[model samples]
Target: MANPDECDTMIVGLGAMGSAALHHLASRGVKVLGVDRFVTPHIHGSTHGRTRIIREAYYEHPCYVPIVQRAYELWAALEKEIGERLFVQTGGLMIGPPEGELFAGALRSATEHGLAHTILEPAEVQARFPGFRVPRGSLALHEPRAGLLLPERCVEAHLALARRAGATIRTGITVTGWTADDGVRIATDAGELRARTLILAAGPWLPALVPDLDLPLNVERQLFHWFEPASHPEWYDAAHSPISLIEYADARFFATFPDVGHGVKAGIHHEGAVIDIDAPRAPASAAEGVEMQALLARYLPQAAGRIVDRATCVYTNTPDHDFLLDRHPAHPNVIIASPCSGHGFKFASAIGEILADLATTGETSFDLGPFAISRFQAPAT
Candidate 1:
């Protein structure tokens, strides 16, 4: 007789990735169980900023283009399946010096993939978009297929669909520990649960769950600020303004979103204080607000207005800023996925399918070389 608590697969952390995994597995008729320390679609994790950019011409790497393309299809399918709007096509602009990594890399990816894009001079950018004040030497790469994804709604839709497909979801319960000696035994704050396979997608809390691996993961404290438009509010409208990233200096970037009822959202990327996962998050300070406002004042002067609201979030970063997705070295039944390095929310839909494939069939059609954990492992002694 099968134990009532036993499931085909058990997943810890029902954030963007885990929730999508649950939906995929359940749709395939797998008896899956998902647990999260907080409620789904909550503000505690990385998926609650209201909007996340989804772009086809990935400046980070050309390899991501295919996966992100697939992600676009999957996100649209999910929207149709659930009957809710999850994405918005506002287009996007990657602005930087011609020789800089942001513009050059985006151009390379667009050229390589044959994506529809146009290279614009500073004058062209300023003329076409009144919201931006691009520097004289900088250029813009405009891609039409880039826009925002409603992250909280996506999570809710995925979890709701998973539940409708017979998956068991437990929230407000933390997974304290797990062992894989005989099947996978998950020790949670609520109680103990067993499953044939275990997946660890706990985001910042992932390190605590797999301490033995000594994984190279760092949690960084990040801030998101929304500000009221100082002038020309029409320039910050969804139809007129495009999501944009400016590489102000070498390897330094910040992003902005059009005011979607709340306020104009903006934040610096990849440069935040290193923090422990368990430490209390400090609120965004006034000095930090000044710093961001200074940037906006120089680039998009109208956006540097009164601060309406601010929120804090953490990024689980790997040393190289790549994702970690692989099975445990010693335990084949266990899979590890997290440390997205702050730029992974857009790809959650495709990654969830990849995780489902890894958990069930132990393989996927997508290339996992760049995301493998072995790159961080030491040479055999």
Candidate 2:
């Protein structure tokens, strides 16, 4: 029998990915143990934002289409199992120039995957969603399946279900260090624990956890703001509007969410300044709020109201801006699963299942080739 402090699999970081992993592993009857530095569903990490966008026609890559599709199924299953409303399908619009990466990529993925989507002109955009006004010559891809996910609730439900499935969960316990020899040895601030395999899903803290590998992970500071619609609040409601990703300028993007009672949320996609993971996150400054308000004035003038609420989060980015989900090169028993590049929250459900599959069976059906760590390494000279 395994010791009380030991388990078949140990997962560090109970944030979005880690929490889902714990739930999936435990559900499969795996003796899994999960640890986190602070209480999960907290605002300290990237998962705390009240809402995150979920879309099927992935503009990032077509490879993400299948993974996200699987995530949709798992998310519904999770909601049913836990009796919680985790996802809201408000549809989604990918707005940008016809040849821009945002619209072109989304169209490519939708066509490649045979996903149902409609292309709309600026007039149609205004006719269908009055709150938004796209620039002339620009276009929008309307995907019926895209929506938003309540992240904190999703993490809470996953952890709750994991505990119910006999998984051991320890909050406020920090993993100081870890090793992988015959098996896996985890050294925590509390004490030491052992597991047959280990999963590193620490998000921004993942790089420090495996210093020997010198993982090239950049922790960027991102901000999110909520505003009361300046006019026609009903036009920005979920019923009237859909989650939108607008590329207002060449290669620049921002996302907007319909008001879900807390005001309409908006955030720039990837213009954040890179920062130290341990640095105290500065609150949204007046200048930052003004910048966001100005941006909204152009595409979503109705959502350019006073900033009722604002918060900051971090994104661990890889150089290629894709996820890094694979086993450690030197330690096969250890899996590194983070660096989601700001857009990973929606896929946490499917990623959790992939992590659980890797931890238990050493493989998964999903093709993770593009996300492998080796993609960053150079060929041996």
Q: List all candidate RMSDs to the true structure.
A: 1.4, 1.1
Assess each prediction's global lDDT (C-alpha) against the native.
0.89, 0.92
Question: Tens digits of per-residue lDDT for model 1 on 37-58?
Answer: 9998887767787888889888
lDDT of 2: 0.92
Pick out the ten consecutive residues of candidate 1 with the lowest summed lDDT.
1-10
Q: Superposing every Cα of model 1 onto the true structure, what RMSD results?
A: 1.4
Which ranges in model 1 have alpha carbons more than 4 Å from their true place? 1-4
How many pairs collide in each candidate, listed in order? Answer: 0, 0
Best by TM-score: 2
lDDT of 2 by residue, 38-157 (tens): 998888778877899999999999999989999999999999999989998899999999999999999999999999999999999999999998999899999999998999999999
Model 2 residue-pair collision total: 0
